[model samples]
Target chain A: MDFFHVLVVLLESTIRVSVPLIFAALAGLFTERAGIFDIGLEGKMLGAAFAAGAVAAVTQSVWMGLLAAILISIALSLVHGYASITQRGNQIVSGVAINFIVAGSTVILGEAWFRQGGRTPALGEGARFQTITFPYADSIREIPILGPIYSDLLSGHFILTYVAFAMVPISWWILYRTRFGLRLRAVGENPGAVDTAGISVIWMRYRAVICCGILCGFAGAYLSLAMTAGFVKGMTAGKGYIALAALIFAKWRPFNIMLACLLFGFLDALAIRLQGNPLPLIGQVPVQLMQALPYILTVILLAGFIGKAIPPKAGGVPYVKER
Target chain B: MSTPYAKLPGWAEYGLIPLVNLAVAFLVAGLVVLLVGENPLEAAYHLINGAFGRGEYLGFTLYYATTFIFTGLAVAVAFHAGLFNIGGEGQAYVGGIGVALACLWLDQTMPWFVVFPLAILGSAFFGAAWAFLPGWLQAKRGSHIVITTIMFNFIASSLMVYLLTRVLKPLGSMSPQTRTFAEGGQLPKLDWLLAIFGLDIGTAPFNVSFLLALVAAFCVWLLIWRTKLGYEMRTMGHSPSAARYAGMSESRITVITMMISGALAGMMALNPIMGEQGRMQLDFVQGAGFVGIAVALMGRSHPAGIIPAAVLFGMLYQGGAEISFEMPSISRDMIVIIQGLVILFAGALENMFRPAIARLFAMQSRRSAVVAQTKGA
Candidate 1:
């Protein structure tokens, strides 16, 4: 109704929309840090979303749904690691193949199991996530900036939304502070050195991939069970790629991933807000341009129009132990 | 990556392995269909009947094959140059813009013959223009070609959506498509060519574009295997340092190679715009460009391999539709699974069985050597 209320709504929408992206970006950070390029992030997320949504709809338990999603996504990760790490296959080709397989299989399996044309039955309230409320939030809403922040911005998001935001710091710690993080970074940079130091390069990469799978699983589960009610076809639609773009935009740093995903989320929220909203100078904006903005921005960033964005040096190259 | 020259005969290397992969994919597809409570054998029959055994359907199958051939060769050309151009989907989508503009401009004044060639060039030019930046970025900016190409695809799709809805839609028409092309914009069907040979068949969308696909294949073969530039591309793809030592400009070659690949992908619009739709429309390219990846990989990035592979996919597409038609339980997504399985086996798992085959070859040679030694003794 008022300008401040609108801003609060927009911020709320931004956080809500960015939950999956934050999870996915963190997921990509793990694999890419270990020198594995995971274009199949999209595929894994899609599979998990479908699995989570279907299981939750049937069993009416969000926890079991989340578990199923994690298992399925982990299975896909194993497939990718086996192909790229064990078989020494082309990583890009393997990723593309995984996308193809997951994209197709999710639909087929959904159709066979549910007979609902690639969608699960929408879940009940018990099967979907509930919002968390901060203490004494409603009583203080009459005040100005802090009131709206308390009432609209910080309060009443699905439980996973907080987890998604919290993951940024946790990821930062895991990637930059822990010994495993140090070893993972070194393994990606020089697997030979890690190998010489008595660490197994194959095992290290597998571990990174497993972490990636878990994060992506959370992202997918959130999309189906928390953000929305059921798994529609391709519900994770390009967010996986968007998270990937965010990954590169942040140069694979965890904190940077948060900033990038939030930025994308804000842009998405703005697009939704600006659907037919008019401005003083610009007049009513076209929906297409707003919809196209994120991609255009990514291209600009990637083309070195903004700044240099380099991936891990050894990313996409399969590590072969020449014995 | 190139495999060491196989000890197995050429047929076994090319034919046996791919066929085995196809068989495995089909077996998985059959199982999926059975899981949905359908008969796989009957489903296969229906697919065959829909693609070929049914009336005039072979023409449609070849029609779909024509588009695959173009996009497949686009991928193959880039592959041979050590570039992964996944943006073929985007390139082809943008190619529709070129064809649309050409038809809109020339239909009012020019003859069909003159307009057709001009439109063909227009499509290639536009598609190449779309791809030029990614190629340039890959060459000069040290960006990964696959990432840049993929990023370009999203941009292309969005750009096309904007162009269609905001710019190209006819006045008072809510639909995001241009008006039907005039006579000068249409390309004659292959039925006319077949009529010249006195072969009567029912009407289908099969067009002269199939012939163009064949000609393009021949030209691609010449360019890759016979030309100086072709030699440079292969050398570069195999080993970039070796190419640099041989005095080739790496950046120029990368740019040129991607442009050529983009042009080939762009040409696929001829069938949909000039042959099937006879007008500009949103989503003219569909998923054909993505499918081209599977085609190129399964074909081993060879023109010789790509043509047959394209035809086989064309069958799967047309037949998959038939399966979805007669049996409601086996939905359209089943076809996508089959396509994915084929990609999994043929591309990702390509080397999975090669070692075993090579072992067999080695064992046979060793047994013969043992027998010869005994005979000499």
Candidate 2:
């Protein structure tokens, strides 16, 4: 392959891999921006992936699968909400518990219902999301540079990929321009201030959590329905955690989140490409190092080497009206 | 507009509440079993029988408990210092490197007794070294320990995979594991200890590590309750502001606490590498580090409580394997569900039933006061 073709292919794969991270990072943005920390994003995504895969396989309807994914993810989100928001519990512990619950339950349910050793059946073409080609893609391919960039790199992606990219601007607008977004940010920074302004901190946080659930559902559905044809056991495989790292790396901003996800996604694509290929000085790059780079970068960022990452002041602490 | 509920008695606070939480967790687990088309009572019967019916089964259960005890104590020690050390998995993973290095180096030249202590030191040193970065980051740089430790877990996993496949694996061996240990590296099984109770271990991997685990628990108890550092750790955990006012160095305590916790977590590798597997292998920690969180939560972060909690999890693990064997429909994941439920009820939603229980106690106290007043009149 020529250099241009390889670059296009790498960028295309980068977009494909980044869709889930985009959706999940945005999901975490909504939740953490409202002062509720959610480490359960991984569990929610895994649960939704299982639900989508199972429903799509059984009914052969991608729409039904999408709905089931949303419902299940929202249910898990609400459980996290109840524990952290209502019960005044430790948010981290609640998140950990939720992660464990969904991790175990999805496998148990999958095994009990499908009996495929904790996997749903492979989805048919009709049951999985189809790639959409933009208009005039075939005719435009004769042109150089811009043609392949538009047709191959930009166009011909699964619908969820477009949705994921679109969510960045929407998230930014919602979190910055809208009143709900302002209240959400306010609640996270200072719940007492939000309460004094005659807003219900509990309700605002719950709404943000619901938004998180909806976005995570898309991420999960994208995993099973768009990226792959079926749900394998542990298919999400630390993507949610990576998304969380991306969120922190982005300093919890929507545009930065998109950039962070794409950067990580690019690293992932490079890792896959460089599996056996040797570079000039480094010799063959170990795939494990590539896989571990996102985490290492995140840890370094968390250590404030690059820049400081300050979470919401009220984050992880349950609000009490009387106290 | 509202009256405060009465304080629970000591038994209810520590004992009764946890028992109720455990009962609720099991009830939910039973419901899950029923959903899977199995009789819950029969499954429970089989689970109990599987854990204790045979001497070998009991031996296996205790063997599993040995690993949990070390990890649990690791988490509990960190908990006492107000740090959540979830990187136990990673710590233990790297700890295997220390163990493998010690065994590989000294097994041929030194006696088993001499090699054992060196291996312990090696494992603790490596594990503590693994944790020191996250700890220092948390203490000095103001980073969240939870996030850093979690990141460390991924880093450790990647590092171990690379090491095992490229560096540690024997030249002729295709598998991603070290060469099997020599006789000096292997821990002797505790068949004689079982013989005192007129039982045969019968192929169980139960070994001297179990005794070491018990000794570690006792040491943890003494350290937490009797030592000056222990008092400082508890003060830090309960109220950091107060600890600061009392002239305690926050950064020093945080780093020391994490290193100690890491060392305990690192020692958990001894059970599997020295006792059971007899070599360093990929993923030998086997989610034991995460299980430490559940154990520590259930145990209320006390050494006394941690022992029983670890054994309970050990029962669940051994019995769950038996259940999966007996009833094909019910897989080992059921134990995971129970564990999640236990952590949920005991750790996060611990106050779910507290209000009702407190009200009940308040009513009883009021009734007693009224009766005493009436009799006096």
Interface C-alpha root-mean-square deviation, candidates in order: 1.6, 0.7
Query: Candidate 2 residues A218-252, lDDT tens each?
Result: 99999999999988888999999999999999999
- The list of candidate 2 runs beyond 4 A from truth reads B1-6, B375-377
Q: Could you say which candidate leads in lDDT?
A: 2
- Candidate 1: tens digits of C-alpha lDDT, residues A59-110: 9999999999999999998888888887777777777877877887788778
Model 1 misplaced stretches (Cα beyond 4 Å) = B1-8, B192-203, B374-377
Question: In order, how many clashes per candidate?
Answer: 0, 0
Q: What is the TM-score of chain B in candidate 2?
A: 0.97
If you assessed candidate 2 against the hidden native complex, which CAPRI class would it receive?
high
Model 1, span B1-377: residue lDDT tens: 44453668788788888888788888988987787788999999989998887446777788889999999999999999999998999999998888888899988778778888888899999888878888998888887788878888888888888888888888899998888988888888777665675554477788878998999999999999999999999999999999999999999999999999999999999899988888878888878998898899889899999999999889888888888889887767776777777877887777777888778888898999999999999
Candidates 1 onward: DockQ, in order: 0.63, 0.83
Error of 1 at B371 (Å): 3.6
How far out, in Å, is residue A88 in model 1? Answer: 1.3
